[model samples]
Target: MPRADFPTPVKNLIAELKRLPGVGPRSAERMAVWLLQNKKAEPTALAEALVLAEEKIISCPACGFFATAEVCEICTDPKRDETLLCVVEQATDVLPLERSGAFKGRYHCLGGKLSPLDRVSPEDLLIPQLISRIEAISGEMEIILALGADVEGEATSNYLADLMRGKPVKITRIAQGLPAGGGLEHADELTLIRALQGRRDF
Candidate 1:
C-alpha cells in the first residue's frame, strides 16, 4: 500500500511532470496530489490515452505530419492541389491553416526551424524530401513558406528560397500578419486566413 503524504510512485510521477517545460516542482506536486485525491479514474484514463497515442501515432511519410499511417489523409486526398505546397515548421501548425479554409494546397512539415546554435541544420529538417517532392510534382507549382515570423524562421525561409532558385517554380512567403515571436499554433483562424491571403514574394 502507498502512503498518503508521499508514495514512491507518486513522487516519481511528480518529478517526471516537473521535467516538462513550463511545469515547476510545486505545480507537478500539486497535480499529483490532486490526481490522488480526486482524479484516480481520470489519471488511469489519461495514462491509457498516452500509451495508445505512443503506440498508434506516427510521422506521415509525405508531409511528416502526425498520423496513424505512413501517408497522412491530406497527402492522400485527391481534392487538394498537388502542385502547390505550403511549408510549415510542424504538424500542429497545420490545424489553424486548415481551419482558416484559405489554403487549397498540401503541406510540408520541416520538423523544425534552422538553429545552428542548437545544432539544427538543413539536413536536420526535411529539406531534401521537400526538394524531391517539388521535383516530382511538375508544372508551375507554388511553394508557400508559412513559417513563423522570427529570426530562425526567417533564416530557414531564406535558405529554402535560395535552394529553390532556378527550379522554374514560384516561391512565396506567408504575410507578416502574425506578430513577431508569435507561433502559428496559437494564431486564430481569421488571422491565419488573412496572412495566407496577403502573402508576398519571398
Candidate 2:
C-alpha cells in the first residue's frame, strides 16, 4: 500500500505557499503546517490582509511606487528635492534608499532592467513614462541611476544615459564596485549611504 501524506486541503495550501519567491517545498510544507496547527497563526487575518492589499495597493503612475492614493507619498512630498530624480530597477528598491536617508529626491522606477536573455526590452519597462516625466520637468535636473551593478542593470543605465545625452538633465550613477552582482534590496543603510554620496557621472 502507498504511504499516506497530508490531506488534499493541506497539500493544496502547501503547493500555494511554494509558489511564493524563495519558498521551497519543505519551507512551504512547514509554513502550511504552522498556519493550520499553530494557535498564534491567524490564517483568516492573513488572508484578509492579503486580499485587502491586492484590492487597494496600486502603483503610483508618476513614480511607480506603491500607493493607496493616485500618487505616492514621495511624489507629493514638498520636502523632497525636485531637482534630483533617482532611477531604480523596481518599486521594492525604493525602500532601501529611503531607509538609507541619503537621497531626499524623487524617484522613477523602471519596473525592470533590460535583459536580452530574459527578453525584457526597453519597451517592456516604463521607459516611455520616464521620458515623459523628464520632459515635464522645467529646470535643470540631475538623474541618479541607482540600479544594481549586474550586467542587465549596467545595460539599462547605459541605455538611459545615452537616451538622455542631449537633454538638459545631468546623469550620474551610484558608485559601483560595491554592490556588484546585488540589487539594492541586499544593501544595508550605511552601504547605500556611501554609494549615494560617492555617485559619479555616467
Candidate 3:
C-alpha cells in the first residue's frame, strides 16, 4: 500500500506542477488539490490546450517567435516598419513589448543571450539567421539590440556590435538608464553613464 493518503494520480499531478518555473512543492500541492477538488472541466480544458499547443506550435523560421505556421504574425505583418528591427532575448520578451505598443517595428528573438559559463555561444543563438534576414530586407535598417542589463547580455551585445561594425546596417543597442517612472536616486553609475550616452536632444 502507498504511504500517503492522496491517490497516485494526485501526487503525480503535484509533481508535474512543481516542474513549472517559480512553483514550489507546497504551491504545486495546493494547485493539484485545487484542480482535483474544483470543477473538473477547467483542468480538462487546460490539459487539452497544453497538449494541443505542444503538438502544433513551432518556432517561426524568420524571427524565432512561436507560431503554428512557418512564419510568425509579426514577421509577416506588412504594416510593421521593415527598416527597424528590435532584437530580444526570447520569444516571450516580444509579447510584452507588443503589449506596451512601444515599438512599431519588426523583431528578432535571439533565443537567448551569450553566457560563456552556461556554454551558450554566438552560434547557439539566431545570429546567422538574423544576418541573413537583414540581407534580405532592403534600405538602411537599424538593428536595435534590446538585450538585458546583465553581464551575459552585455557580452552578447558587445559581440553583436563588433560583428555588425562597418556593415551596411546601423547597429544600435537598447539604452539602459533610469526608467521613465523611476527616480534618479535609485539609478546606478552604469545606468547614469548609459543614460548620458543614449540621450537625445529634447
Candidate 4:
C-alpha cells in the first residue's frame, strides 16, 4: 500500500509558507498544520490582511520607506532634521534605528547594496535620487551611512563616499565592531543607539 500524504491544499499552503525567509520546509508544514488545526488561528483574517497590505502599501517616493500615501510620515514630519540624512540598505533597516530614538534625521533607503558578484550595481539602487536630494539642499548637510557591517556594505559605503567626494556634504558611516549579529534587523535598540552615537567620518 502507498503511504498517505498531506492533502493537496495543505501541501500548497506549506509550499507558500516555505517561500518566506527563514522558514524551512518542516517549519512551513508545522505552521500550515497549526493554522488549520489551532482554534485561535484566523486564516481568513490573515489572508485578508496580506491582500490589504499588498494592495494599499507602497514605497514612499521621497524616501524608500513603506507608505500608504504619496510620501512616508518621516519625510513629511517637520520636526525631523532636514540637514541630516541617514542612508540604509533597505526599508526594514529604518525601523530599528527609529526604535532606538537616537536618530532624528531624515532617511534614504538605497534599496540594496553594491554587489558585483550578485550583479547589483549602483544603477540598481536609489543613488540618483539620493544625489538629487543632496543637491536640493542649500546649506551644509551630513549623510550618515547606516548600512550593514558586511563586505558588500563596506564596498557600497566606500563607493558612495567617493561618488560624493566633491559634494557640499559630510559623509560619515556608523561605528562598526558592534554586535549587530548580521544586519540592522537583528540588532537591538541599545546597539543601534551606540552605533549612531559613535559614527565617524567615512
Top candidate by lDDT: 4
lDDT of 1 by residue, 1-202 (tens): 9656777899899998999899998999988888778845488888899999999999998899888887888998999998889999999999999998999889999999999899999989999999999999768899999998778998999999999999968999876667789999999887797788887789
lDDT of 4 by residue, 1-202 (tens): 9999999999999999999999999999999999999989999999999999999999999989999999999998999999999999999999999999999999999999999999999999999999999999999999999998778988999999999999999998877546645788877776677678777789
Q: List the residue pairs that clash in candidate 3.
A: none
Candidate 4 TM-score, true structure as reference: 0.88
Off by over 4 Å in 2: 177-202
Displacement of the residue 131 alpha carbon in candidate 2, Å: 0.6
Better of 1 and 4 by TM-score: 4
lDDT of 2 by residue, 150-187 (tens): 78988999999999999999999877434568888888
Candidate 4 has an lDDT of 0.94
Q: Candidate 3 versus the native: TM-score?
A: 0.91
Shift in Å, residue 198, candidate 4: 6.7
Candidate number with the higher TM-score (1 or 3) = 3
* Highest TM-score model number: 3
Off by over 4 Å in 4: 178-202
Residue pairs in steric clash, candidate 1? none
TM-score of each: 0.84, 0.87, 0.91, 0.88
lDDT pick, better of 2 and 3: 2
